[model samples]
Target: MVSTRVDELNSERHRFALGIFMAVVVAHWAEHLAQAVQIYVLGIPRPAAGGVLGSVLPWLVHSEALHYGYALVMLIGLVALRPGFVGRARTWWTAALVIQVWHHFEHLLLLGQVVAGANLAGRPVPTSVLQLAVPRVELHLFYNAVVFAPMVVAMILHRKPSADERALTRCQCARPVLV
Candidate 1:
């Protein structure tokens, strides 16, 4: 029963779901890029450097709830869409999934710190282990790029698979394999 439902999710009719997930991911990426520009190019302080949506809802950028929610969404999206890929694409997708899992863990760690009122490594605000080396804004940008890149590659490969890949694919994501 569950397998049937999962197969449905990976079907061509449900491509819209994948589209929506990618849209959300792209929007989040834009926000991070905008924030980076505000900081490095505009000389704005991190606290004041609200991105597009952040300008309207200034608290959004600093909200642990928002950060953690997005991380959770990304993780869920990756896992749910994974079965659609095959061969090389499946490998790339798995890579992205692994990275996203780590990214989710980092967010969870940060959320835990925020809840506990103690930052990692004695920082004033909640911080991830990597945040000790890179600022939160920058670290998140790096994470998003790494995760996004592989997912994009996977999507491209999924759409146009080789013979072996087409044979391996369970979903109709790629062109139909010829005899």
Candidate 2:
């Protein structure tokens, strides 16, 4: 009884949840891309070249609360939706999840530094270890790319699973078998 309900939820309902999560992820990606273009292509200064939402809420770019909140959201979404994947999709998803865990930890560290009024490695601003070598904006872009790439691959594999993968799947998100 409970197993059937779980299967149903992982089918249609899981897909819906994944769709919403992907939308949010894409929006965040757009913001980062916009910020990058503004800085590199448009030659706009970082403080003035607010991204899409940043133009309206400029403070959001520098807000620890916003950064930490989004990191938490991504972490939660990855973990919650993970069970629906199987085989190769599960492998790719696990890779993304691991990277996101690290990414979330970095954000947590930055947020903590901001709240404590201290910067890491004696820098002027709160910084992740990677940010020590790469600029914050660029580092974040790289981080997002790595995380997003594996996740996208996982989603593709999930939608079109191999026979073995289909067998291993616990959800109905994969393409239906033809009679």
Candidate 3:
């Protein structure tokens, strides 16, 4: 039953799965955008700008567990639905997955520091390697943008694949030429 369900997800439910995954990704992006607006447009102090949800629950923004959980979810979504894509779409999807892998590790690094009560390079807060060069907020925005770009490309290609790709795919995501 489990194997059959997995196959069904990749074949029949792939479109729905992709939609849900992209929705979650977009929501995360919106949160980052909101945070940026809070900092830059609203003139909120960097220490206090926690985006929309963060406004109500400030701890959510600061929680390493929340950030790491999101990274893990992104990675899992990419890996779980990969088999539904083919050819160029698959290649782009793989690219997103690879980048998300690194993103997940960065979050893991932050979570690890919090868990051990030790910050990188003696900083007060948990810091990722890239965070050494870039602040955490901007660094995460950059990471999400990179991952989301390839995901967009893959979705576009998956929906309107080349004829060759259409022949190779197992999912019902490809759209027919309307001309």
Candidate 4:
């Protein structure tokens, strides 16, 4: 009785999870395609386009196939990692995405400072735990706030119920046979 309802809820969460993943994947891919066309085909220099919008676009674009491929694989693989995690899906996913964004920011900040031409210092900062590139720092904050935060918050706040929406929502054992 309860188990059947749970199964239905789990299925619903799975569908929602898949939808979220697909949306992100498509958006990422679209960004990449746009960048490839803009940078390679259109021949726009990264520096010449220096601005908020300019930097935002490149973060989504990856010239390397393996880079995008790894993200796609991870996104797909997360589905089967746990059979019963469907209910708290939004909570876990929101947390996971926050971690992902933080990791990404670390890399972005590092690359911006260390990579050639990315440095706003006009020269590299040496022996510095905090390089403090104002432009890059501002952009980083903006990106996290505008792009990552809203998405994560929306998912968390509007999470639809799933089988395990709560541990006590329904028991996890097999459903009893219907007469």
Predicted candidate 1 versus true structure: per-residue lDDT over 1-179, tens digit per residue: 98888888887644677789999999999999999999999999989998889978998988997899999999999998887777898899999999999999999998998888988888888889898899888899999999999999988898899977777676666656567
lDDT of 2 by residue, 43-141 (tens): 999778768899898899989879999999999889878878888998999999999999999999999999999999899888998899898889989
* lDDT (C-alpha, whole model) for all candidates: 0.88, 0.89, 0.93, 0.43
TM-score for candidate 3? 0.97
Comparing candidate 1 with candidate 4, which one achieves the higher lDDT? 1
lDDT of 3 by residue, 108-174 (tens): 9999999999999999999999999998789988999999999999999999999889988788888
What's the best-to-worst order under TM-score? 3, 1, 2, 4
Clashing pairs in 4: none
- Candidate no. 2 TM-score: 0.92
Off by over 4 Å in 4: 1-10, 48-179
lDDT of 4: 0.43
Angstrom error of the Cα, residue 147, model 4: value is 20
Against the hidden reference, what TM-scores do the models get?
A: 0.92, 0.92, 0.97, 0.31
* lDDT of candidate model 3 versus the reference: 0.93
The lowest-lDDT stretch of 10 consecutive residues in candidate 1 is: 169-178
Writing each residue's lDDT as its tens digit, candidate 4 over 34-83 gives: 54455556787744432333467553322223343543454333433234
* Candidate ranking (lDDT, best to worst): 3, 2, 1, 4
